[model samples]
Each structure stands twice: as structure tokens, then as C-alpha cells.
Target: MRWRAGVVAALAVAVLLGACGGGEEPVAATASRTPKPLPISTPTSIQQRCFVPVEGGLTTFTGPEGSTMPGAVLGEGADVAVFLHQTSAAGFCGWATYADWVASKDVKAVLVDLCGWGRSACKGGFAADAEAQVRLLVDWAREHGARRVTVVGASMGGAIALGVGQRAGADALVDLSGPAVWQGVPTAGEAAKETTVPLLLAVAPGDRGMDPPALRAAVKAAPAKHKRFVSTRGSHGWDMLNDGALTEPKWSPLAHDVLAWVKGEYRAG
Candidate 1:
């Protein structure tokens, strides 16, 4: 009887161990499973606009082709400077830092959205087809009672300004981080040869995109009567946006230099 009771107890213990092991398998499997999280999307219908006040009333105007390109118009009257948008013609935010500098010298500032970007006519991608767009805007500005028009372009837009200056006969042209030779666009060398307007070229030390040596060579080779080159201590478009505000250096000096240049520092016959 003792041997039989011991056998029964041993068998029961083995059965309990087996049941516990089996139960743990399902728990282990469930713990190993994981569900993925859903992806988030950006909103499409967000309007882009930012307002900053200056000495003069806001200069409101549409884009070249009647499209919505809102910009701030500062300065009292007559004296005007048109700030052309870069590759992305969003607002004048790219040149926002220079607003006060521009306004201080009794010069009106017009920051515009280019045709292809922002709230302009051609949305999504660049509108290289609309080469004459800047010319049209310059013409419109002059028509609206602008006495002396100075065109300022950043990066690709700078190249565009050179062309516009030639076509519209602008008083002065400023090119910030503008390439001397654009891949598909007309080069500054080409424009400079034909342009009678005074030109200011602002190049940053960190401008890898622009061939500084070639640009310098081109400037030397060009046939413009008046031309100047300024080298800064940053990357391309530094004077305009300043690497998305990563650094704290003020860019008003660039505007001051350009304004001074525009104010008869360099004049072409």
C-alpha cells in the first residue's frame, strides 16, 4: 500500500508540471507579437501668410500673371526696392530679416512670391517656362508709380533678376548666392555682357553650389561697366534666409551693403 501511494503522488506531480509548461507556451507566443503604428499625413489646404509692419504702409500686389503673390510694401513713396523670391516663391520671409534695414534708408521694400511656388499661378515645381515673369512684375511696379526700381534676387532668382534688369531696364540689380552659370538657365556672364545696369554679386564662403572661382573668372571676363562681388562667411543664400535661422548673426549688413551700392555706389553709363 505505501509503494502504490508513492507512485500515485509522483504521477500527479509530473501531470501538474506538464500543464504549467503548456500554459506558458501561449503566453510566450502572445508576448512575442507586435502591432505596427499608423503613419501621419500633412494637411494640403494650409494657406501661407506672415505680416510684419514697417514705416510705410503695406505694399500689396498680386503676382506677374494675376496670381496671388502677397508681399509687404514698406517706405513712404517713390523710392522702391523689389525683393524677388528664390526658387520657392513663398512670402518675403526669405528676406524678412532685412526689412528694417531696407526701411531705414527711406527705401520701399516689395517682397513677392514667385510664379511657380507659394500661392502663385504655377504651383508645385519651378516654372522655368515663365522666364518673363520677373520682367512683368518689374514693369507692373514701375507702372504703379515707382520712381526708382531696384531688383534683388536670391539664388536662382538672382539669375532671373539679371535677365529682368536687362529686359525692364532696372536701375540696380543684386544677386545673392546666385550661380554664375545655371545648368538650364542663361548665365550671369551672358546677362552681364548685355546688361547696362549696375550689378552686385554676394557670395558666401560656404557656397559649394556656386563655383566661386568660375564666378570670379566670369566677372573678370564679363563686359559690364559696373560690377561688385562681396564674400560673406556662410553658405549660399546666407544673407536671405541664414540656414533656416540656425545661427544668430544678423543679415541686415547685406541689405545695407546692397542699398548703399544701389544708392549710386556703382553706376553704369
Candidate 2:
């Protein structure tokens, strides 16, 4: 698959930011500007199984046969949320909070430890080779009778998910704190040009390290008929996890919004 050049440029920027010894100023500033309102609904939590093996070694994580991913399941039936963790993070790291949020909306949630990360084997890092692992996960989701798979990826995981959504089939793709382009990774625009699935591009207002302009440019280049951009407050991955203020809202309106979009697309077909 073809990677995005813009993503490469953005990754360079990230590296530069890191080299400058800068803290998360962009994200913090953005968060400060937004109102700290709680979610409208409280979400529940569910646990599930995932298992898959990659080139590095045999995966020992949970999941059904033919899959080796550690994840949790929430909600019921076809309304499912599949969460992909970032690099060096486990499925359970911040899964419960998101799972509970999804469950409150009655949406089943599946949080997976990606290959080479968490309990899964690592053949090569998040390089081009990671694409195979993503493909395997997508295939497993389809085989397991998943009516519709809505993928949410964070950081490196977001990059992987974008690659999968670009070439592999999926219902919807959500990019959280993921750069439009990573080092040798495809930009969301590049992925969008080839992907048929609905795409939601989300960026943290405070992520000065990230170039939202580049991401927006990529979205404009995407081929998907349905594409939307959302701006969230706080650091890249912090807001969605347990430590964030939106961890448990009285009403999980965000989950509902995501599910509504997925269901609309699934039903349209």
C-alpha cells in the first residue's frame, strides 16, 4: 500500500518538537479554551476475548481461536466499538473507561492489544510491516460475524488503523491524536482517497505538537463520501482515557454520536 508523504513531514515535525524539549503546550492551551463539560450519560463496561498471532511470535493474548488479541466487549449485538491501543500500551490500560462509555449507549466495545504491542508479538515495530498485523485483525473481525466495525486508534495505533481503513474494509475510522502523517506512514488524506468507509478525523485543540492543518488537508483529499472533523480538548490520548474529565459522563453523548454515524452507514448499505 502507498503511504502518505505529508504524514512523513508531520512526523518530522513531531520529532523536532520532541527535540526542542517542549512540553504539550499546544494541547494544554487548546484544552484551556474549551469548556470542561461532563458527558451527558454514564457508560457501562463489558469484557470480551481476542487472540491473533503475528510474524514475531505466537500471540498469547485473549480472543477466540484464530485471533490473539487482548480486549474487552461491551454493549450488545451489532452495535460494537473496537478500540485499538497505542504503542507500548495494553488493551486494559484505559479500556474500561471507554468501554463503560460505549456500553452506556448500548454499543458493544472491543479493545485489542495490537501486534508487537501489549501481549501480542512484535515482528518489526510500527514500520510498514505492522500493516500485515492490522490486516489480520480486520479479517478476524469480519470472520467473527461483526456486522459493522468502528475502529478508534490512538497515536501509533491510530496510524495503523488509518492504514487498515484505507485498504482493508471497515464501517468507520476514527483518528484520535494521530498525526495526519507519521514517519513513513500514510496520511489520513492518502488513506481517505482509497477508503470507502466513513471517516472521522479528530484532533486535540491543545496538540501543538500535531499539525491539524495537515490533517485537515488530508481529509479534504480523502475519497470517502462521508467525512467529518471534530476538535476535542486536552492532550492527544488523555481526554478519552480514565484520567480525563470526560471519563464517565452522565450522558455519553460522544459514544452515541459515533454509534449513530456507524449505524447510519451500515443501514445505508
Candidate 3:
């Protein structure tokens, strides 16, 4: 969940050494640098980076068809938030930062690799088998002491979350840039109509080829009494949860809104 501090230290050494080898007069290495160095904890575009799995936190589950699914769990509590990854090959690692953030709030964070992605390369790939496996996990969580379960997903995983949330009877749902229709599974719009739990539907305008207006409208008209439609300006799916969430290009309120909803503070906006 943290960036490597050695990278910043190495950069600082390079800058200081460069000052010592100056042209006209060798500048003192002890002199102050022009621009301040970035902090060690500064967040980058993590979703685009390759993530090594966290050491020793890995767990496995057996699907109905006997396939093994690997995942990691962070934090522990009666309330659980299950994260499904977007279509990216990075899989559940894409949700690592956000999951850690959720764990800090005392909620159990469940990060799964879905079926074909990450370490769970099953026979059927990302087909109906993946959704079935997620549904099984949801039930598994409930049986294992989760009082309330909220399913959250992005892109392709988002669409699967909607369907799984409905069929699995999750207490709440968060869908980020999920397509209305993905492959041959159930339509997200239809799943949205059937979702009775509190829902948060977030999408960036002009995200890839997604129709934000239609997606927003569908969530707006969903039967869930507590539902919100957020319009953000950022790259699609997992990229929306960035360090510059309050700044331009990432939109001012996207990350905050999602967290608020995650914490059960569902403001009607």
C-alpha cells in the first residue's frame, strides 16, 4: 500500500551529485536545491503499474466447479466490502490501494482475482463461471460472519458486480464505469433495475466508448431508494481512484464521494 522510499532518496542523491559537478564554479552539495523533492508517499498512476502480490496475505477459495480462486483480505470487521477488478490484466492488484484505504476505516476489504485474471487462470476464462465464483464468495463471506456485504467493481468487473449483487443479495453496490451489456452475461441495466439495495453508480464522461448519460439515467431510475449518479472527468474505470482526485483531470469529488458511500454515508445528490 506504500510506495518505495528508496526511489526518492536515490533521486535526491542524483540531484545533489549533479550540483557538485557544475560548470563554471562547482556548486556546494550542501546548498539548497531549487525545487523541493517529492514526498516518499506521493501516489502515482498505480493502476498502470505492475504490482507484486502482497507477501503472505494470499488466500484461496474453491469454486463450485472445483477451480481454485486466489484473493487477499485486508482488515477485519462485521461489515465487508468485496472488490472486483476491472477488465485490466492487472486484476485485483488494481484495487490494492483502495482496499487498504477501506481497511483503515475498520471494514473488511475482500480483493478477488475473479477467475481468469491474476492467479486464478481457470478453464472457462471470464465467462459465466467468473460470476458464479463471485456469487459463491459472497455467500461464503456471509457464512463466515460478515453482517453486511457491499460489492464494488470497475469496468467489466463492475457489470459483474451488478449482476452478482442482485443475485447474491448484497447489502449495497458500487459500480464504476460498468457497461450496460458486456459479452453474453445479463445486461447491467436490467440488473440495475432489479437492485433494491443502496447503490452508487459512478462514471467519467467520455470514458472510453461508454454512454455515461444512459448509464447515469439507468441508475437514477433504479428502484433503490438510496442511489446516486456521479459524473467525473478522468480515465476510465480503476484510474478514477487516484491521488489527484480533488484536482482537475481527476475531478474534484469522485474519490471522496465513493468513499463516503462506502462508509455508509449515502448522501442523495
Candidate 4:
């Protein structure tokens, strides 16, 4: 009986102590403060800054396959169409060095790897390939909502540009160290007579296929009245566009002239 009473008294005391909070000033229950999360910010999409359809990349163009023409897009501005030609297996990014010119001229560039070249799965050769592939480039530009577009090419690319530019009536055409004697064009002179679009043909001083004589013949044949042949100092192909590369930032005289011609701001020659 005494043990049971003792147990009851102990239970009563515990209850009383708990109610009084052990009389230690009753430790205030501090509510944990959870800092409100800072506002999450959203960044602008890269596609907005660069071209939406195509972003910048290395030599190989990772775009669509087959007729899509594997290529990369450079700069954000537009109305200008740039079609790149291959000197070898290198990617079209090599021409990206001219982005400065493309920017200054408010131009957009599409570096193409034609059939059997770069990343293009489509197969064809030179002039024959140009007729079809160049259409793709033109169609791509049109799809992008470009109001005006030009075609720029290097080496064999230049010859292709001439073939397409003449037929397509491109806003302008830029040929950098291209050939005078392509399969169908036969001669730059012949290609020149076919189009009235503003044309700029640039050649390195000692290029094998585009020496001064050939350049003269081509220029003489250009009936645009605004056509010009700029002889520069550098290697062949697109390398001489500006200070030997599209990798270089500054605009060359060649780039300036081409841009001016495209802008319809050049004087008749």
C-alpha cells in the first residue's frame, strides 16, 4: 500500500514540474527562421542573342541532314546570305573570322559544307551541285525572313556562287579566289555576262587559279557596271578575306567592298 502511494506521488510531482517548465525561466520556444528564398531569375535564351535556327559552332555544321545543307550560322543580323566553300575537309567555321565584317555590314552568315564536303550528306559536284545546294541556301535565307541576301564563296565555292548568283539574281555576289574555268561556266567571263547583280571578285596576288590575267578577264566580262576586282596579298581561297582569315577580327578592303556592294552603296566602276 505504501509503495503504491509513493508511485502516485512521484507521478503527480512530474506532472507539476512539466507544467511549471522546471522553473528555469521557462526557456522560450524559438521558432526556426527559414529565410525566404531569393527570387529566381531567368536568363535570356542563347538563341535570342545568336541566330535562333542555328548557333555558332566549330568547322563541322551540325544542322539537319541531306538537302538541309550541313552548316553553321554566324552573327545575329541579316538580309545577307553567306555560302561558304571548302578548301579541304575543314569546317566552314574557318570563315567565321569574317564575323566582324558580317557585323559591320549588318549581315548574317551561313557557312555551308556542300555535297561530298564538310557535314553535308548530299552528294554532287561543282556547278551541278551548286544549282541545287545554292537553292537550299537561298531557301534557308527566305525561311529566316531575310529581305535581301548575297552569296559569298571561296575557291570552288566562288565558282559555285557565280553559277547560283547569276541564275538566282542574288542581291550581290562575292567570289574570293574562285575559278575562271568551272565545268559549266567554262569561264568567269561567261558567268559574268549572265547576271546583272553587283559582283565583287577578290584574288590573292599569286593565286594559282586566279592570277591577274584571269581576274581581268572575269572583271571585263562583268556587265553590272558596279563590278570590281580587288587584288589582295595573301593565300588562296577564303583565307584572304581579311588579314588572312575569318579568324581575324578586322575587316579587309575586300570585305568592305563586298559589303558596300551588297548595301548598294558602291560607285559604278
TM-score top scorer: 3
Model 2 C-alpha lDDT per residue in residues 1-269, reported as the tens digit of each score: 23688788889999898788665787788889998888764212222222221111122333333445544455565655566676654454454565555656656666656654655544433323555555555566667667877777777667666766545566788777677666545766677677667777667666756677777676677777887766665556424433444333443334445556645542221
Better of 1 and 2 by lDDT: 1
Candidates' C-alpha lDDT:
0.63, 0.59, 0.73, 0.64
Task: Give the poorly placed runs of model 1, Cα more than 4 Å off.
Answer: 1-48, 51-66, 123-131, 238-252, 267-269
TM-score of each: 0.67, 0.64, 0.73, 0.68
Task: TM-score winner between 1 and 3, please give it.
Answer: 3
Candidate 3 vs 4: which has more TM-score: 3
On TM-score, the stronger of 1 and 4 is: 4
lDDT of 1 by residue, 179-204 (tens): 77764456877776676666777777
Off by over 4 Å in 4: 1-68, 123-128, 184-186, 244-248
lDDT of 4: 0.64
User: Per-residue lDDT for 1-269 in model 4, tens only?
Assistant: 99999999999998898887774433433323545689975313222222233235533322333243556666656566676674667545456556435655577767766666654565334324556567667767777877777888888778878766767547788788887777644467778777688788888777775656776677777778577777778777766655642233455666666667655565554
What's the number of clashes in each of the models?
1, 30, 0, 4
**Candidate 3: tens digits of C-alpha lDDT, residues 1-269:** 13568888878887887777743244444454457778765223233233432332667776655577677777877778888898757667777776766676878888877776876755554335545767777887798789888888899888887766767767888888888777745676777778788889888887746678778877866899899888877677777877533222232366667766766778997
**Model 1: which ten-residue window has the lowest total lDDT?**
43-52
Kindly report the root-mean-square deviation of model 2 from the true structure over all alpha carbons. Answer: 23.8
